[model samples]
Target: MHRQYVVNLSRIREVERRFKGELFLVMDDQEQTMVPVSRRNAPAVRRALQI
Candidate 1:
């Protein structure tokens, strides 16, 4: 699909939930996912994961 957002998807938390707490995204096609948000660094999560 190769889709991307340029208008700033500020509601990235919703994306985190959609994947059932998957913090990391697959860098390779044959890899597991991640729940990019953490309770300890939730604020950073927003910036690091580009929320």
Candidate 2:
């Protein structure tokens, strides 16, 4: 089954310092996952995370 999670932007920024390549780590309420933010969404992600 596929599960969807909602990771807060604050959490994303908390780990932004550890960004690797085009992927970054995010810890949701349950687990951690790497997010591959696409070019299209990169701007928004950066703006949101203030990276």
Candidate 3:
């Protein structure tokens, strides 16, 4: 089944530190996922999230 999750942009943490690379970290139900993103396209992601 296909499902969709609505994530709060404010809740997502953006990490740009060394060894981590550029990513959007989303944590829920004690589980977390790091979504890789490019610096050039970051603004688009933010816009899509309505942040």
Candidate 4:
């Protein structure tokens, strides 16, 4: 069996731009994991975050 955990968008603390226009979103949670965003999806992701 598998389980999926969802983090609220409101917990995003920082958005870092990576190489080749990639992005990393830092969530201010207990683990503080960095979620990568593809270059092609950066625009849409930014729009959703309203950054």
Candidate 5:
């Protein structure tokens, strides 16, 4: 499987732009899983997901 950031950019971006503070992803595929990221990576992670 791909790295967490490599896979979900859009969701990351939405979290960056629209939401504030810590981010959490609740994927339908991975229930009860947690994907935590650095604050610095948050923006790029989001942009990549948009692709």
Candidate 6:
């Protein structure tokens, strides 16, 4: 079985701050896990996060 988790944008910003504004592929504090961001979704993610 596989498990999935949802993280909020605010958390993402926290991670970005921890990484010094780098959000390409970050490990959020809540999960402390790194998930790969696909090339297709990269732009959308950046736009949503405003990074």
Using Cα atoms with residue i matched to residue i, what is each candidate's TM-score against the true structure? 0.32, 0.48, 0.42, 0.71, 0.43, 0.50
Arranged by lDDT with the best first, the candidates are 4, 2, 3, 6, 5, 1
lDDT of each: 0.39, 0.53, 0.51, 0.73, 0.45, 0.50
- When sorted by TM-score, best at the front, the candidate numbers are 4, 6, 2, 5, 3, 1
| lDDT for 6 (candidate 1) | 24
Clashes of each: 8, 0, 0, 0, 3, 0
List runs of model 6 lying over 4 Å from the truth: 1-5, 13-24
| Candidate 5 off by > 4 Å | 1-20, 28-30
Number of the top-ranking candidate, with lDDT as the measure: 4
Is 1 or 5 the stronger prediction by lDDT? 5
Q: Compute the lDDT of residue 16 as modeled in candidate 2.
A: 39
**Which candidate would rank higher by lDDT, 4 or 6?**
4
Mark the regions of model 3 whose C-alpha exceeds 4 Å error after superposition: 1-23, 27-30
- Flag regions of model 2 displaced more than 4 Å: 1-6, 13-21, 28-31
How far residue 35's Cα lies from its native spot in candidate 2, in Å, is 1.6
Worst 10 residues of 5 by lDDT: 9-18
In candidate 3, residue 36 scores what lDDT? 55
Return the TM-score for candidate 2, rounded to 2 decimals: 0.48
